[model samples]
Target: MIAYDLMKRLKELGYIKEERDPYWWPKSGSFEVVVGAVLTQNTKWENVEKALENLKNELGSIEPQKIVEMDQKRLAALIKPAGFYNTKAFRIQKLVHNMLDEYGSFEAFQKRPSRSWLLAQKGIGFETADSILNYACYKDFLVVDAYTARILNFLGYELQTYQEIQEFLSDSILENLDRIYELYGQEMPLSQIYARFHGKIVEFCKEHCKGRDQAEKIKELLV
Candidate 1:
């Protein structure tokens, strides 16, 4: 099936039916997403949550300026639950410093995002950068993670790289904008569509794409 068809199926299965906190990422446009994006690398969301809670408890907030002023060692200890604490702390600090220097604040950066600048950061790769853009900046960039690749591969697509997978799914949805509106009964923004689509994939995979019976489970759902 095509990406649109899969998205329709996932929606029908009751994913993203209502507004929720941490729907895909923490409330969109929050600075916590920026920090969570980095902390989430090579770790589970639960671990990321622990680290975020630690930060919120310690600093009472997770602002970029606060992170910039905080000591790296202390920051590392707070985020240690997410793993690679030392490296992630450094990267997070560097990102916040550069972002503040360039955009002055998280609100300003959200107003005018720069994908190239995000990618140029030390630990911000394509996925991490795209997460910040899509979730934090509310951009129309679809995030392709391992779940996306696995689901597509199970659907008989031979996409080999991140770009190919992202392009295929994005183009499919873009080309069928009218159908999407009909499906949802409203003209949703592309950013929201991409966000919900990624959320559906992650949720679906978590529920039905585990263990040796993964392929069978996916086939049953698609069928």
Candidate 2:
């Protein structure tokens, strides 16, 4: 099945029903997404949520400047539930410091983000950078992860690289923009499409990509 077909199926299955908080990711354009993107690496979202709650309770908000000003040890302690606390804390602080130095604030960075600049950060890779771009900055960049690779492999695609998988899914949706508009009953922006599409993929895989019948179940549902 193609990416748009999967998107349609997921939508029918009741995913991405609205643009709001309490979804797979935080609300769009929140710095929490940037922090969650980094903390979510090699960890589950539940742990990330716990860590985020700790930060919120301690700092009142997940501000970049507050994070940069806080001691690394304290930061690590608050985010310990997310795993790799010390390392993630260092990476987060460095990223926030650089963001403030370059863009002055998260609002400024949101106004004008640089993918290349994000890639230059200590721990930000393609997936993480794209997560921030798509979810946090509301850019028309699709974020793919291990779930995407697994789902595509089950669907009989030979895409072996991140760029290939991303391009395939993105081009599929772009090619069917008119159909997508028809499906949604309005002209949705490319960034919103990318966000919901990625969210659907992640949520679908989490629900069905488990147990010994994982491949069979996914094929049965989507194919």
Candidate 3:
């Protein structure tokens, strides 16, 4: 199999998510994905969950407007479990404040977040921006993270940039969807395919595929 074919190989190895979840992401299109996407940077998802629970309990619902109007110190306190809470709270505030001033609602913001809009914000990076675009708005941007880069390296391609890997994997996977359907016997929407592709890559790396020899474990399923 080619380096970018790892996602398809993973599915053949029984790694793709089978559930067509109603709430595909934790809280699809909700403020939670936005908050989690920001808080998750440099932190574990477990920590993000703890911080999210704190926010949910405090605000009764995760609303961008509520966050925009929140006191920075208090917001930081609620997200303290995620660590770097002070900075993260300010970052979320920056994003929410922008949403409020320009778009006026998450719905509006999600509808028209031009490619560089989120990236031009205070704290959004490539992965975080793509996370929000893909998970929050269900946009068709592919998410690439450390696990993706690491696994690809193990497959003998050492990419140096996030956009490079993201575009490469996305183009490769979408171009190979026919092969994927043939192998898995099902067709998935592009959003779900990208979402699950990222999810499965993270899961596979966390579960049985790790170390510098990550590719070795899945060699049998290679195309």
Which pairs, if any, clash in model 3? none
At residue 40, give the lDDT of candidate 2.
95
Q: After superposition, how far is residue 203 of candidate 2 from its true place, in Å?
A: 1.0
TM-score of 3: 0.89
lDDT of 1 by residue, 1-223 (tens): 2878998999888886445654366667798899999999999988999999999999998888799999999999999999999999999999999999999999999988999999999988889999999999889999999999999878778999989999999999999999998998999889988888998898888777887647756967974
Candidate 1 global lDDT: 0.89
Could you tell me how far off, in angstroms, the CA of residue 14 lies in candidate 2 after the best superposition?
A: 2.2
Q: How many backbone clashes does candidate 1 have?
A: 0
Worst 10 residues of 2 by lDDT: 16-25
Once fitted onto the true fold, the runs of candidate 3 whose alpha carbons sit more than 4 angstroms away are: 1-4, 17-24, 209-223
126-147, model 3: which lDDT tens digit per residue? Answer: 9999889888888898889998
Candidate 1 has what TM-score?
Answer: 0.94
lDDT (0-100) at residue 222 of candidate 2? 83
Counting clashing residue pairs in each candidate, in order, gives 0, 0, 0
